[model samples]
Target: MKNISKFIKIIKTLNFIPVLSVFAISSSCSNKINYNSSTDYENNQNFSDIDERDQVLNIIKKADFVKFDSEDINKIYDNFNYYTKGNASPYIKIKKSLQLFEKYWKIDKNSEPWVINILNKYDGPDITIDAINDEIIINKYDKNKTQEVNNYVEMFGDSIIINKKVCNFGYDKKIKTSEYGFKIISYENDILIPYYIFNTLFLSPNYINLYYDGTKYQLFEKIVNFDNKKFKNFFDCAFPGITPFKEIREDSYNSLKFLMNNYYGLNKYYEYTSWESILDKYRDAMLDINPDNYTGAYFNFFNSLNDLHSNIIIPSLFNYRIKYYQQSNKRKTYAKLDNQLKNRRSLILENSDQNTNFFGYLRNNLFISFDEFTQNMNVKGKDFELKNLFLSSILKLKNHKDVNNIIIDLSTNGGGDLSIMLWIAKLLSKDKEISFYNYNDLNESLIKSTLSESKFSTQYLSKDFIQAKNILKSKQVILLVSNNTFSAANLLTSIVKDYDLGLIIGAKTGGGMASIMPTVLADGTSVAISSNNLFLNKNRTQIEDGIEPDIKLPYDDFYDFRKMEQAINNFQKTK
Candidate 1:
């Protein structure tokens, strides 16, 4: 009875489309059209007839029905049977399963459960395949045969071909079966269409994907292995627009469906009372039938996936990190200049035995508080521009003379814009020119940064963007730093210590250093590309080890101001 009804169902589906009769074409259109010269005849042919045929061909072409040759199709079938014929080992069985999966899925990056389910059957005790309700779980096998997976070449007479390489799998020993019985990768996801995926891929589905993942409707691949010619003819009839007699197989249908579903795997899930109820009540959506709230409902359903890697979204949300950064820059103009200037200054007193000034300020002379540095570029936020504020403060302090021998503390400072650091260095020197290391040309690379008497980094180094080479040659400087001082902060410290520009006294600095441009992905996610590698001073020391201070102060002594004061007093007396 079931077999009888299957034929009836196919007939019913065929009712809407007209099946082309070869006899009818031969009788009516043979005189006017030369089948052999069909391409040329298209121009001379009746435009209306040509358009009709084109539309029919378009529909047929899209339908998954036919393929190029019988031999290619048979090869897949033969391969499956060959592996299944013997009581093959788990590895061999897995290979056969993967062969079928590849044939079905073709080429895609991520894992699709439909294809993965087939592979589960071939796994040893280490893998368990379960379909409870409408959910499919593929987990590690329980068997503890912890032997590494051997190379296919080592195990078999022939090597496994991957990316045109024979037995390249041995390069990474980790991928080879470790002390485990077999190499396995497990994944978990709610079933989309329990009936369809399970039946087509797993060969069984106990329940429909109704209440499983809150999905109201699910799409499934329906694969039919038939005689190549018969399948092609059926495909031509069902979808007349698609060209007939093309290569079509179960694998082709599986591959196309896999791509579409994976590419458009809607994050949305449907809520239902039960799996049985969904199959009985809501299967029509799979057929692409129209509903009342068409567009809105469709989009709402589509957006449910929420996965940026797999799901689609509106234009606004696409490439989100980049857009946010751009938007932030646009709003930078609205930020008041004075507020930015106020934030750059770090007010701290330098207590020296011979110092005349109190509340001695060593401003963020670099980039003169981020304002003068990031001046024209549109960027927003106090946190994002925290370095700018520090620079602004340093600039303010450079001109104030109530301050004497400066103490520029990079102790806990993580690092920021290199331009800002250079500015600060220039201000400390008091000379119009200050020479510092250039990352690009370290062999004998020299940069002269400049500062105005009143402002931090007021001048630029024209030679290598030099502005203040003279002032740095004259000032008495004390540089304080610690392990937390890293990146941009470390870069500045490296210059101060190497050139003897300042007396650096503290613990080793945090060495994290990388110069990279930030790139925002289409989904508004930001990523940094660390392409250029920057090195330390001419000593050839790498930044990864961080900059060690010339004088290593006791950790407690540095933190205790009273201890530091006593130490400074003792030094002054000795002088």
Candidate 2:
């Protein structure tokens, strides 16, 4: 069923224009045209009078019946059996099912112009196939309708052999697939329908099958149902000159609503309000089906949730319009604070290169600052390079005997790459094991481990334990955080506060501790939501509300190095 669905999705992109008009003119035009009845042959013309091409064309025009050689038909049957393991249907029964698809090739007045306009806009080439007298006639067309016809000698099970050149089906010529998966080649002017994909248009089911008999008729029935539904939906276009349909908008809305109800991590947090009422308010706006209304509804809904990791993406819009919903009040406060901090010239050392300036000494105190934790595994040795850079910084900090205070600044960091965050936590904490909690409605579990026990490709450095214990045991460690410190950064702050590893200063860290899960809706709208893996503190309390600072200071004062140093020293003295 999955393979059949994939096949249907591929065929939906094909340029299935009404080829009857092209065939009639390209063949014998002397034969009079009759639009009322398809079976009316002009003047009761005998088959022996015209050439082989004319006879095949006349048969297509009169009866809508496509003729194919016994061997060619057998090749289809053999491939079908091989792929389905002979479980679909017998050869005789499957042949009967093929007749149901002949009407799909017949001309329709309304669909022809719509399909052709889309094909022309996308620069998709037109193709026609005719099997006649043990050979196949193939016609290829450009956007201007310039046609070229060629006779193909042999047909493989999944491809056509033309002039000893094999054009394999089911695989894109430009975009090749590697062992890992599809590797994108280019996004422009690369629309070519493979033969196997066309075969699926006639063979596979396009809709869900409730009564699965494992027969070919069951599959054929689904294709017929889906085409009928799609044809009706074509008239429900949302905007003029735009191809998106109203049904697509409705489907997108319903699908996203379903996912939010079942899988979103913050469902319990919104228990104060009625979730159904909030969704009902947005439902009508989303279903209105215009571009502005649909996108606006999604934007408003996500903002109401106030989760930073959740958003909607419309790809057809220029540059792929993305809208994120976040805590409005918190963000507004942070924005004003950030502007003020930027204007002041603090005593902290500034460096343009983040990689080279992870750690530095500031008046007998060691400060480590990073915008984000990234492990670029796509680049050859990027992760290894980052690991070595961090190790060198840690070793330097460990050897500095004059350093008494360690300040980890994460004021503007938005967090990324969980494994890298854990690795850094292990290097800065004095304890041998770090502990946190993961909470879903179904279960709540504590996760405690050393860096060596990580499932990801992270290992403890050679002197990580020794260096961390030497510096952390005798000195005070402080964390500087702000509203922008979110996701994994937020989780790190919570861990520091929960385990008494450090003192937090500045404003509260922005809370976005859940892992993100992104999915594409039925209408091709991309949506991301916080997943069920919600982060929690050691007391089994939700960390989504953020962590408060132990020694809070104004944003402007926090930016001044002397003031921050004084606050840290005063807080340690009281302890």
Candidate 3:
């Protein structure tokens, strides 16, 4: 399950694509690719591919299996005797239960009506992964008294003997016991398959992935691991296309230095030009720096990007105060423009209470006012109430002869789940599927994505679309835009424009079409990277470039209802 914005508050709080469900439970995005929906594993024997390690494991399975079930536990212990014998496989499958979690970052830049925020998702509790191969004997037994995972160093030999290095007294600690566990993977609609993300955090899942292959489960892909050897553990791409920032493990000070060198880890492009100089100032003095100093340094680093889509987020539970830094003058100007727009919005909608409804009408202009992409809507999870609210509004406007024009106002909307986009699209067109594709730079394929998909996503979306068969067809649509319109919200405008559903009006949107994911530092600090690149087509040439209004409105006249009123009338006349 994948939603690249897995580790930051700025992107996290902005109600983004609810996917992979921490291995997310949410669903649906683009075209007819059946994609890896989570439900495929809703009943999976967890994340173990025992079939691949049969040669290495002497475990047993029941007809219906839960990886950590008591019977499964008993069988592993029953076979533990064999595992101890020389004849048994060389690996010790650590029979332990643990739950892993992935976090998210949100796009909170210095702008009006947009605040800095981060969202967190845990992979759930008491979840464990299985280590079935001799490779497990090689990879497991994290030393440091189980505090830190040690890296595997290959011994130069005819058969390539490998050994784990001694970092301190911790290296002496080892796993004497054997048992069973299971792996859980996260997938995203932005990405088709879950990529291997290997680090100290995950040394084994980095090596293999299991797939359905149309019929039965099989070893879909095998990835090679790379040794970062910075701290104690190795950093490698566990997920094929998405890898975490491994250099951060080298030194606490090296986090920004490493990321600046590889900013694409969470983004497609690097915006900072002073990287060499910035690194020169901060790289060598890491050991002496305080946490607040480190926080300031990272904050300044992100501030330099001047990118609304990206930011440096400190974990909320960790509750570290990020030392505030002043925004660049260029950033200040952008923020000012947004303030003006908000003021103008106030003047135009003065008569209407702004907070009550997500959709409404003012005179002949039917307005769909959606401000954010969070799941905490009228109701929770399914978005059923929000759907009905929007659908009902559209239906009412369609019947009202006075409503000859439509204004889909997404000015303050910061985008949440992709399904919400499709649900809105369902009301606009008869074509149910929001057909599109993406290119993952790491995977280098249009068909693949940064995260794995789940059946749950596909099934739920398919059902949601099916239920909304009739739409407000052929109505003249005019979309309102602003600089804050972003991510999935930005995508909504792009989709509407791509399908010729409407005319865009206002400023160009924030262009952050890439799906981003997080990687953690040795200190448990998390930073993110744009693990996947998104494109609008199979050729991978075009992407969801920020939307430019077909009819650009003047900045000063944003508050002037006459401008929008005239545009709506002019739009209707042309229709």
- How do all models score by TM-score? 0.30, 0.53, 0.52
Model 2 TM: 0.53
Candidate 1 residue lDDT tens string, 24-81: 1011211222335433112232324322311211111110111223344312122111
Evaluate all candidate structures by whole-model CA lDDT and list the values in order.
Answer: 0.29, 0.43, 0.38
Deviation in Å, model 3, residue 415 alpha carbon: 1.8
Q: After superposing candidate 1 on the true structure, give the runs of residues whose Cα lies further than 4 Å from its correct spot.
A: 1-403, 429-475, 520-525, 554-559, 568-575
In candidate 2 the C-alpha lDDT for residue 104 amounts to 37
Off by over 4 Å in 3: 1-250, 254-278, 285-287, 315-319, 322-338, 351-357, 376-384, 448-471, 533-539, 542-545, 559-561, 568-575
Clashes of 3: 74
lDDT, candidate 3, residue 119?
18
- Alpha-carbon runs more than 4 Å astray in model 2: 1-242, 272-274, 315-358, 376-386, 442-461, 464-469
Give lDDT tens digits, candidate 2, residues 479-574: 889887788888889888877887899988888866665443434344556654455665656777788999998876865778988887788799
- lDDT score of model 2? 0.43
- CA RMSD of each candidate after superposition: 24.9, 21.1, 19.9
